[model samples]
Target: MAGVDPDDCCRGAHAAAQRGEFTQATVWDACRTGIRDAIESQLDDEQASPVIIDGLPTIGKTQHATDIAFGLDVPAAILTHRYETRDEHLNLAAEHQKTVAEIPTLDRDCPTRRGDHGSGWAERINDYRSRGASPTYLHYYLQDALPCMQDGDCPYLARWDAVEGADVVIGGPAHAALDRVVDDRVVIFDEDPGTAFRTEFDANQLSTAISTFLRRNDDLPVDNHFGLIGAATNESMDAIRDAIRDELSDNISIASPREAVDDDDGHAEAPTAVLAMLELGGPIIGDTAPAEYDWDDQLREEAGLDYVELPDGSQVVYDHAESRIIIRRPPDLTDSRAVVGLDGTPVEELWRGRLGVDDIESWRILCDDCRARYLRDVIGYTFVQTTSHVKPYSSGEYVNRRADFGLIEAVENRHETAPGVITTKSAAERLFEESPSEPFIDIQRVTNRIADVKHYGALRSSNDFTGTEVGIVLGSPHPGDRPLQITAALEGYTAVRDDEGKGTDLDYGIPDRPFLRHYREHKIAQAVLRFGRTTAATVYIHTGVLPEWLAEMVTAGPETVMIDERSEGQRGVIRALLDEAPGTAAEIAKRERVSIGEKQTRDWLKRLRSEGYVSRDDSQPYTWAADGLADAPHTARVRLPDLE
Candidate 1:
């Protein structure tokens, strides 16, 4: 779009028409003006306010973003995860495209399919040599600029000559970091975690005498006391933690911010000293970490201070995003230009808080029911398998070296089969080399039936299977992994347990032995929100183990293949209780329909009683009763002293 005009969208519509884009007669949906006005007001300000487009994922947020660029008659640089997202960038990027030769870079290797490798690779090599820099050398020497750099006109920063003229700039955080962005250019961060940056510290640096002692001794370590804090007591957690420690110790500072948070916070639900040493690059420097994240909470856990020593077997969780909010808003990447954030999660408060800008304009645009509709399109299983979190017990004596942990399978396998299964990385590892299960085989058949679409990767993670009929997540990765489930973490997806008896929000126990409990609840739901991105998702729970995490069909949306929880012979007992009269434990045991002896009857009755199907009398001779049961039996195992 060229030549701004008084009529808000006049020039934009014209340009889009000329370009044969944004042709929708009613391109702007219900919230168009709210967003349009926000952008315009920002532009009018001597200093533009960063806009946050907030709503559920897969709604028209992206469309609205594109419309804003068009409505304002400004060129846009769109940043997105997939190639298909290119269309979202304002028509400006298309105008900015340059042949490979046009991109100024120290890299002279003009890789081409049309080439003689010897001559092709060599010609570019010489071009790089002539520039007084090797292809490997960053021309502007921008490799070392901080997030708050003030260096001007570094060829390395603006080397993408195209970006200089580009109306808007789009790309990942790396693109956002480049000095190419100018005061006039508007920047948009499409996802959360926005554009903050962190550097890494060495994990080994965090090691101390206390941590080393805890490693070999039997004092029963405190939550965050040693380097092993948050690790499963078992060999699995210990092994992974040690390996991570090694990886951290070996770091030579590979360049650039990683896809996930590389520092402390990314290692698990929150930052630990080890992860802080390995991943958190700063000092967190001058920028305050997100307020939602409680730094002190983590500290208290590390010191085992401020915690009550509880009775044994109580659950204790150090602070995490769930119990309390830790604010992670980083300092502004730029002070001079406009920056906008687009998000699908319904968290205006969270995003605005993260932006930490007093004047950031946040609006909640209505989301469509497109997500629910997608749910109706698929059906699948949500397997609930249990794994052990065992660590060798260590007293003053020798340690038991045995560690048993069983979890799900690889990223690809969990994704490839099923109407879209949700599993953990650990679970995926279990199935990594195995063939699809019987149900999984059927899922594959269904997926394969779609000739033009595949339901493998993105479909399973979301309620909106926009491009395919189904979506499956290769199970959500454990928080301990480096990818940093940002969407999940942002939605307060941090796991919680009550076993530690502490007042903390996070479990400093072994990280992944849960391969189940911690993962299933938050992982699936978040996968649905971020869908392809792993924010939230869930499958029906079919287990005798944990039914609380199970959900009704259409977990993500309306579509579902819900299999009821397996009865496992509990139904017969339930049926027997339908209208039975109060009876002695022995009488109940002899009922022909019960089909079980006294021992079996006791177990079944206990199960039924706990679930509310049966009630036991507390009188003289206690008896069990349900709908058909008569008044309480005179047979209590012992009469409660008749209360006066």
Candidate 2:
């Protein structure tokens, strides 16, 4: 297995995620042996059993997959040609499929040469009826065996040469990888292990299918597609599921019972006829994962009558609440083909049950002591809500100010890594391996304090920071609820769900609260990686949940460590103290146009006095001034106080 370059590993993972695409072998050089061996075992095994290694990111699973793909060049064919060519071909002409295309070239660290390219691949695949055209049936499915990040690099049918042994195929995520699984081959799942069983249903397509079917003859409620029978909303998925199941059973005769059930017959059951008609419609409109024992499967003569159990232990149904749902049955590991998956986190029992595995192979080789980091610091900051009586603490101007103050205080004492505000694009770019710098921040430069965040942000933009001088990176959870948004990108959530994260059979809206917690885990993890790698990176997290790993790492966990005391607004208040008349807290709040009450201002004034930032003047109602400015307090203003 390849070792991580201490300096590059953190940024490499970030870069890998942030970059335009992942194709370079260099981006996947850091790896773990457990992952490598697991994949190799699956490939070498005669029994095609799936394998999964649960571990964390930055531990080198992607690197191992990349290495295996480039190093081992073997070939296998899922569909083959038969000489009897006349008799009938057991080819897959139609069983429903996703988009996949063949390319003639290879680049970005592929390690095999294409020889003996298979024949007949160029033939059009007849959806489920492909075998109808015998002789050339499925002969085109042959491919050269080379481990690749994507199937694009798999050796193609050069001359239809016979391949030996079990085939190993790889992809960027579980969905992509699952597509290439063929008979008698090991399916290596080193990417997106968390998504092994997520099922995405297309609601829009379901609506269309039901809509078109109801147009001809309505045996049931026609409005809104049989009323609640075909509604596309999350809550309606379960009800619609029952409606469809009952309809299929009512119309038992194979070919749609000759004609539609007469509407005038008052056949009050759901339009079983309409549901059957939908099967003939575009498969795109209504889809499910694990190939349910539905009209579609029966229509194709797939010879299966089973429903996959979902992760929640509930029998698989049209579950509407989850945007992505896992189901009971294991994927078709044709011929017992092996599949290996690796991750840092423990494997879920839901997946284990699906894979027919009882125990998860778990281990780790990373820690604060690992040489890959200089300081494995994990900080937890608890902050009080930064809201005044007038407005909620939202991701707007007020929150930005609160964030700036917290972040400044967190990193103020450290003169190590350069400090600046890092947006998602830059953070992922700086961290993921695939994302490389065009021109980026100078990590070595240290600033006294970061101010004017918007302007500082503009200066660090692409080609904006042209100076050789250093740059800054402001730290913490970003102002908005962005951490959770980025969390969706982690485990194939974005692949199956719509922009709103709704699935065909599920709604992901429930995770909004949990996503906030998950996102904080990432924040703390990133803080440990990007900042703790070189110095004791201090992260001030005001919102979202903290990662359990980091929460336990630090003793004084992050609480409402309000740094509101050292802000420009407070500085303005200090400046207001320069009033020649030496006014009270109400007078100061009025001068600054601040909505913060006089009591809050007076409390701050007193706090500033105790911190030696301001001195009280011998006047009525006792006003404050910058230290040593009591005498000339009326005319001259001094610098804002700094953290000692």
Candidate 3:
């Protein structure tokens, strides 16, 4: 027996050993031996049994096959499903530094006439025969003739006969020629071990292919020379096994497949353990032990591990052992710990303080398998939705409403485009000139928010007064439900408008005034509140209505209560006092010398506070202040009467 590199052949065998499949270990060992023997044999005799190998994605199957082919000093031809154009083939050939011939399928070329002939009685009949060529027959013919074709004879002619004579054929799953090739050639199926057997071919085509290959070659000398290796996903091995049994009777193999190693005996080797670990989720900081960490106990406990427990009490589980890692929980200790490799090298660590409690809990539940698969697949593109009227302004309001509905976290309004009802480019120009800085908000600066708006329209002319209305619209990187809070904001705007137009002749104009301003203000407030809670970021409110006096009140100190738009100075002063210090109406009445008038003030303040502008903090004196104003910068400090 030839000496097999421990790193090259031990992974799958180790997994088999864990499953207690002793026979599988032998087979795995034999497969490696066969590869080495085949290489040496090829050196001694120009023709040797073709080496066949198979496995799931990332399970080292291709690596092993490549190594074997390289060892034998023979060229390898990889047939893939993605092979399309001659350019693609040429590119792959250049990449692998090997010649590639694609199997032609039913497409535009198969039924087309090669040469133009005058359509006539005789030529028509000849054309019909030429155009009626079968794809399968052409495929077969090409496979047999292409390799020997001279340079100018037709580039598509590189056929399967060439594959048969080649040193190695690294084939992907394609049924037509593979079934026939299995008879005289060494064949390998590079499948994703995690769910390779679950492929459509296994469910439908594998049985027929295997049976046909077996039946066709029955008469040939029973040479241990022909090898069959099925690469299984470490994650979905059970599925693969079931697929195999579904295809053939259980009695075909030497014995039921077994684990290639003994867990208690640490001598099993690292590559096997590494494969098992990769299947679970590649090594993780604080979750997986360094290779140097004595793994005797771990190996024993996870003898057939569906999950692995690290020293810190966090557990890493395997979902699709062949493809993903799912981190279930990190160690209990908050010490910044990470996953380390066998060489005690740190891979990655969970971000401390960056994640919320819910996110932390979620991270813990992730198993090794998902992590491995997802780490490389994380999305790189950042997407933002844009529409005509639905640009940044209305979109910001929609985002705020979404945040209220817990659909998003924050919304920052950047700019506003004039309502689409304005006619003429000149009118738009005028509106923009009046509010030049209010075009569209740059979406890049905002985080965790949705963008949505009311509607889009094109103006007829500058003087056209009929303001056409439209419904609300939304856009985002990913789709989500429309927020109900936005509807409430719209309703609030409508209520305020109806109240304002209580006795006006131009009440109809009320609908045309664009309810966006009301919506924008409310959304800004909401965004500020959410920002404070989620990211601990400051919220700056820049508005024309935000009085300089009120700015001073908030800026001087963290004042929770803000009262503005008051009609009478007395009422405003009394209300502001009571807001700064909440108490019974009777106590306020005594202080203000107003006979139960303080009750009315108290009632108004209570209503305003309930509307989300102000809130009461738990203090001995029971202080009240603006809720969303927590992070508002102190642009101006207003002197208020010391109510205490």
Model 2 regions lying over 4 Å from their true place: 1-31, 43-49, 73-171, 174-187, 193-205, 213-224, 227-331, 335-337, 350-360, 363-549, 559-603, 612-644
Ranking by TM-score: 2, 1, 3
Clash totals for all candidate models: 82, 76, 65
Better of 1 and 3 by TM-score: 1
Per-residue lDDT of model 2, residues 223-311, tens digit only: 44444333422333554555544544454321221121222221211233234322222222345421233333431222112123222
TM-scores of all predicted structures: 0.42, 0.44, 0.23
Summing lDDT over every window of 10 consecutive residues in candidate 1, give the lowest-scoring window. Answer: 399-408
Which candidate tops TM-score? 2
What's the TM for model 2?
A: 0.44
CA RMSD of each candidate after superposition: 18.6, 16.6, 27.0
Q: State the lDDT at 78 in candidate 2.
A: 21
The sequence of per-residue lDDT tens digits that candidate 1 reaches over residues 1-644 is 11233343443233344456532222234235445655566667757657776544444455566555544455444455433454344443344442111223323222211133456534543433332222223223323432212444433335466656644544543333344442445555555543243222233323332243234334333334333434423333545555654543354322222211223222211222333322221112213332323443433333221111111111112222222112132333454346667654424434443444555655544322322322322212222222111111111011110101001111112333333343343343333323442211122322232222222133221334433322333322234322123222332333233355332122433353232333333334444333332222323221222213223332332122221221323333444565466676577767655656777776767755654447888865558778422211101111111101
lDDT-based ranking, best first? 1, 2, 3
Q: Single out the weakest 10-residue window by summed lDDT for candidate 3.
A: 338-347
Model 3 TM-score, all chains together: 0.23
